[model samples]
Structure formats: C-alpha cells, structure tokens
Target: EEKIPGVYGIDTRALTKLLREKGSLLGKITFEGGEDIEFHDPNQENLIAKVSTKEIVEYGSGDKTVVLVDCGTKYNIIRCLLRLGVKVVFVPWDYDFTQMEYDGLFISNGPGSPEFAEITVEHIRKAMEIGKPICGICMGNQLLCKAAGAKVYKLKYGHRSHNQPVRLVGTEKCYITSQNHGFAVDNSTIPSEWEPHFINMNDGTNEGIRHKTKPFFSAQFHPEASSGPKDTEFIFEEFVNLL
Candidate 1:
C-alpha cells in the first residue's frame, strides 16, 4: 500500500530567515496529486471589496463623528475610538463618504497588498481634498501613503510580533508596539509635505508618517494593542486631539 503524503510540520525558524532575506512573495502549496494546480496571487485582486463592511455600522455616541473606512478593521480600533468618547461610523472601503458630515476620517487595517485597495485610496484622496483630519493603522498606513503619492513595498520577514520597538522621529523616546503586516511605506518616496513620524528600532523601517502642517498621520503598529502591550496607546489620544 502507498502512504498518503501530507505536511508533518514546518520549520518556522528557517522560513522566517528565508522571508527576511527574500521579502514577501507570491507562492502556493500543492499536494502530490495536485501539482498542476495554478497559484494565484491575492495581492493582484481587489481585496478591499472582500474585506470591507458592506453596511454602515455605528458605535458610541460622542460629540465627534469619525468616519471609519472598514478594510477588515480590527475590533480594538473601534473599541479605542469609543473609549475616547467619539462616534464611529464604519463604512465600506470603496464608499464615497464625502457627503457625510464627520469630524475625522480613519482608515483601518486589513489583509493583502495596499495597492489592491485602489478605491479606498481614492476615498482617502477625497478626504484629503476636503482637509479632514486623518489617521490610519496597519494597512491603513500603506493606503495613506498611496494617497499621498508615496510608494509601498513588501518587507522581508515584515513586523509581525508584539514587542516590536519604534522610536518617535526626532525624539529619543521609544515605545514597544504591536505589529502585524508584510508591507511597508518606502521612506525615500515620501513627499516633502510629509515626514517620517516613527521608525522601527530593530530594522530602521518606516513605522509611521505625518503631514508637515496637516492633521494627517498614520502608524504601522496597532496602538490599541488587542493582544499586546499598550505602550503606544497614547496614539489614539493624539488622534482624538487632532480632531
């Protein structure tokens, strides 16, 4: 009798090393009998449509209304916003929310490459046209960069740990942060109107960006820190203050 083949285990340590050296790439797994199956790259598709909230969802009853572009937003992002005494209205990633009255615009975290979320990028560009205070997290950061004419690229091994350290730009202050993403904004591509706000201490990668005189900013880390440290929880407070 022939034995069936299956994965016994994965060498995560070696995989991590390889990813670090080669950056993120498109690949696939196949069984011996399924060797002819094709591998499709999810990054090339419109990921926002699959991940965004179809219907508008509201939370909290604070005076300020924050229009949250739902790109598979994490629950903690809403939780933190509610805790800040602000009203959150979660809209689809491709929704044209310019007609809606709001105090701020927030872009949420999600999966796949930010380039695939072209509609969300356009919405952000519209928000910028209206001069709304904007804040983003995780994938949100990359989308904001795209809206600002900046470029994003896949990171080698990315920042996917809880205790990643990030230092505030032009400051000696460092904060332990929670991160989970495979792409990063290219620091060299940021326009003159914006500046690098935070940097990863371990690898010197761009961790955040901020507009020079506009109330626009974004972080690659999860400041809400659902299952991680709260060292950067003040980021939420800062966003609220911007409004």
Candidate 2:
C-alpha cells in the first residue's frame, strides 16, 4: 500500500458506476476529528507546471533533432523517438524553443485545462509560422488546436481507457487507440485550413486534427501506448518521417 493514507468503507464499484453515469465529479474525503480540507479540483490547477521539467534535458544522439515541449510528458514518448534515432531536446511547458534549431516541434501530452498553457499555445503558433514539422498527443492535441485558433472543451466523463476506436477523417480505416483525456478539441471551430483528421467512433468527438497543407498535426490518443494498446504506434513513425 506504500503506507499511503486512504479512506475506507466506500463501495468502489458503485462509485465507479456513478462516475461513469454522471461524468466526473469533485469530492473531498474527511474523517471524524480530522482537520477539514478544501475541495481540490485538479482540472483547475496548472498540472503541467507541476509535472514538466524545470530545465532543458537532452536525450539520444541521432541526426534529426526534435524539440519536445514537456507539458507533463510521458517517458515512452522519448523512448519511441530514441528508438527512431532522433535527438530529443526536452523543455518545460512555457520555455521558448522557436529560437533554437530543430527539425520538428513536439507538444507532449499533459493534464488540466489548455488555458493554463497559453504561453505554449503562443509558442506553437510561432513555430507554425516557420513551417517546422509539428506533432502532439493527448493534451498536446488540445494545445495544438488552440494554437490553430480552435476551441477546446471539457469532456463529460472523458475517454480514460485503453481501447478507444478512432476512424480516419474520410476513410473507413479505424484504429483502436489508448486515451486518457478530460478535454477535446472542437472540430467545428477548427480553421478552414485545418481539418479534423480523426474521429472518435464512440462519442464522435474530435480525436485528431491536421493542417490542410502544412506538416502540423496532433492526436488526442496516446500512440506510445505505455500501459495500453499499440495499435497507433505508426503515428510516431509518420511524424518522424516528416522531419
């Protein structure tokens, strides 16, 4: 148990059913004679700032260099890129990477609202101006959409499972992807130059988006999988090839 503190006597199965049916909820736990604590809503906090690296970190020694915005990134993303032999320059969520030289710009997946990373959105917009290859995953998708002038909204219950089905924009080809997001990009608000690239088959939410003519794209699902399916691992190769 790691000796961690926990509240007991609650029916976890019923709680799970309630969350599934009523969407996400904010609650606080207390015990008799314990000091009262205010309810905490994680979504309202800048979780990226808490999880992102405070200093720049470099990994691998490949020819192609990738500037990865560490908005609470998963290590597997670096592992996947390293496997493809690309040099990854990891930076914090708000660090400016436009001045530095890199073949591509990667916005890493994160937690919380995209509004907290407005600086990141601005940086991505500037990077887009230079036409550098850009790719993002999960929360990365929301930030990318915001950078492109699209709207992002919180999901009801959110896609927090390993087996989420997403279909290509105009094709029947579908891939089972790993997802854990509480927000999604609004496809209708996407600019004309950018189109919805993928659609969630379950809820018809925007799963991904891409520029019409530029090498900019993002996915709301994890291609790295980590603890989930590997059906979308090809996404990494596709982004790397662009670089």
Candidate 3:
C-alpha cells in the first residue's frame, strides 16, 4: 500500500496533457477533510543540501580513484563506477574536493536549481584548472556549465523518461537515453572554449557539453540507468578511459 496520502480516480491523461502545455505547476493534492495548504516550489529550495551526504564516504579499493561529488546522487552511479574498478570517494554537495588527491572528478545528479550549488561550481572551477579528468551527470552537467560561465534555466515540465532521444554533436549517431532533470543549459550562452557534446532530438536543446581540448565533459541524462536503455552505459567507460 502507498504510505503517502493520495486522491485518485482523476483523468491522469488530461492532467499530463495540461502539464505538457502549461509546464510545471505547483499544486497540492487535498483529500476530504484535509486543510488547504500552500503549494511550495521545490526549485527555489537547495534540495542538494538536504539530500547530499553530511560527511565523506569511500567505496571499494582500486588503483584509479574517483572523487564523486554527491548532490543527491543515485546509488546506481556509484555502482557503475565501482563496476569499472574505480575507488570512489563520495563527498557532500558543497564539500571542497579539489584539495583531495584523485585521478578523476565526477559530479553526480541532484535536484533543484544550480544556483544554490554555487559553492560546488567554484570547486569545479578549481578542478578544471587542475586538469584532472572530470565528468558530470544531470545537475552535475548544469554545475559544470555554470563553472564555465554558461547559463542554466528551468525546463518546461522537464525531461523524465527512459526513451528520450539524443544525437551526438557533429555526427549522425543517435542514442536513446534516460533523463530526469528540470533544468537545461543554454547553448547560446555556452562559452566559446566549450562545445555541445550532445543535443536533444525532440527540443534541439543541449544535452551534453565538453571542453575543446580537456578531459572535461558532462551529460544531462542518466547513463547508469538500471531500468532504462543500456545504450549510454558506454559513457562510464568513456569517463574511465579518461582516468
């Protein structure tokens, strides 16, 4: 049984259509005799701080070490890296990871706007100069863009499915992906030194970005999709290759 209170029997299809047309809306589901409540917008909150680990955590023991900046990261992300024989040093969202010795840096997916994680972005800027291989996923992608001076904005309704199509930049190849983010990087605002790595086929939005000549890149989708397509699992390999 569902633990949370819920009101059912509504036309979910109509609601989905309305959301598609009107974008993300804030609303409260009220049951009979329930008091009216204000709809809170989670986007304005620093959800990363709330969900990120409070202290440093390490997993596995491998020669190649990866400092994973946890911003509400999925367990599958760590599992994927650990599968690659990477010793993972999981840290908090705002932790200063630049000081730690590691072969690669990874920014994991998280919730809410990238603005709240400015501290993490600052650390990323430092990591970028350090020249260690770096990879980011979802909100991590947004933070990397922010570190590079690119702008990020909230998406309309957001991408939340396993079948989203993405095309490689400057190539004809396309991959079906799993995604669940409500913000996107503004390609037009992306700096000259960095270029788009992937593009969303449906909306033509930037799905990924990479530095011109550095081992720095990020994807706005989940490559460690346990229940979704395996096409992008190669992404973890690509990141490991950088290490």
Candidate 4:
C-alpha cells in the first residue's frame, strides 16, 4: 500500500503482516508473487527492505502428518497439506533420516536437480528399508525416482509453470496439473523396486511412482495447488487413505 509500507517475502506465514497494525511501523512485505504486505516502521529508513530477510521458521508441527520441505512450493503448499488433516515437519535436504523420527513423510515440491538431495535420498533409503508411507511431488518425485535406483536428467529450460498433462499409468486417463521443476526422472534407469504410476502425456516423462510393496508413492505435480485445476485433488484423499 502506498499509504503504508510493510515486510514482504516468498515465505507467507503472516507474522510480519500481522505485526503491522501497530501504525508506528512501516512494513512492505510480499510473499513470492503474492499480495504486497505493508504497514509502518518509523525508526528505520526504508523498512520494507530491512525487515530481516532471514527465514523465521515458516513450518509447524502436528500429530497428524510429517513432511520434508525445500525452498520452492512456498508456504501456501504446506497450508493445503495441513487443511487435509496433515501435520507437517520441514526436513532439510541433508538431515540424516536415521537420526530423526516422524510419521508418514511427504517429499515437498521444490526446484533443482533431484541429485542435489543427498540427505533426502539417504533418509528415503532408510524409510524404504522399514516400509514407510512416503509421498513425493515435483522435485520430490525426482528424488524418489533417483533414490530408488533411477537417474535424473536436467531438462533444458525446465517445466516451471502450470498446466501439464499427466496420464494415469494403467487407466490412460489424463489429468492436467500445476508443475514447476527443472529435472525429470529417467525411466530407463528406474529400479524394479519402484513402480511407475503416472506418466506425462506431453513429454512421456515419469509423473508418478509407487513402491511395489511399500506404502510409499509420489506424483510429479502439485495436488496441493494454490489455485490450479483440481483434477488430481483426489490424490490427497488417496494419500490419507494410504496413511
């Protein structure tokens, strides 16, 4: 707001905005492509740019679900998962899964090559060793594919927007989805232990996978989409059912 300036960021937990009603503060906050968050900060010069760009624990915990997170997908993605009766925990890319504990795990949406996730892969291997219900999306999908003995190749320019055509593996039905990623799972290297469930109709890329014998599975698109099509919203129901 021109009349007021506030703190803004891609992390939309609403803490900075709520703190703005003090009137003595000037805050101009905006979460990645989201609305502008403005208020007032009198003491500082240009308060909007100085509102501590650091990440202030955007995640919370609950008894219902647990999730692994990255820099992409933003906080809105987590909100959707929470609304579905899931309590999520943000696991970084390098934490040893064997050290920590949680319930069903959700590999979150993110950008970058899946190979960049050495820690996630290690923890995933451990989860599979014990048979956990895991779900991966976007980069999460690529990580699962690679962790289960598949290879990931960087796409030139990558798929960074919404509206992708995905087909159910057996049904041959198409579901348009919101996608954002720069890499894809190489089907040729997918291990027999992981069963590919969905395929991208446009590029023939691996869009989803499930373990043949484990309760874990994943999709390459966002079912928790902020405002995208709801064609795959049932995936959330299926995930809770699997849990």
**135-241 in candidate 4: lDDT tens per residue?**
87777777777778888876543554678888988785898888776567778887787778888877788887888887888888887777577789787667766
How well does candidate 4 score on lDDT at residue 140? Answer: 75
For residue 29, give model 4's deviation from the true position in Å.
Answer: 27
**Global local distance difference test of model 2:** 0.92
Candidate 3 vs candidate 4, lDDT winner? 3
Q: How do the predictions measure up, each by TM-score?
A: 0.89, 0.93, 0.94, 0.70
lDDT of 3 by residue, 124-146 (tens): 99999999999999999999999
Clashes of 2: 0
Question: For candidate 1, lDDT tens digit of each residue in 1-243?
Answer: 577655657898998788778876666667766557777878677766897888998998999999998998989999999999999999998889888999999999998888778887888998999998999999899999999999998887678899999999999999999999989999999999999999999999999899999999999999988899999889889999988
Error of 1 at 240 (Å): 0.9
Best model per TM-score: 3
Candidate 1 vs candidate 2: which has greater lDDT?
Answer: 2
Q: For every candidate structure, what is the RMSD over all alpha carbons to the true structure, in angstroms? A: 3.4, 1.9, 1.7, 12.7
Query: In every candidate, how many clashes are there?
Result: 0, 0, 0, 21
The Cα local distance difference test for each model comes to 0.90, 0.92, 0.93, 0.67
lDDT of 4: 0.67
Q: Which segments of candidate 2 are over 4 A away from where they belong?
A: 1-21
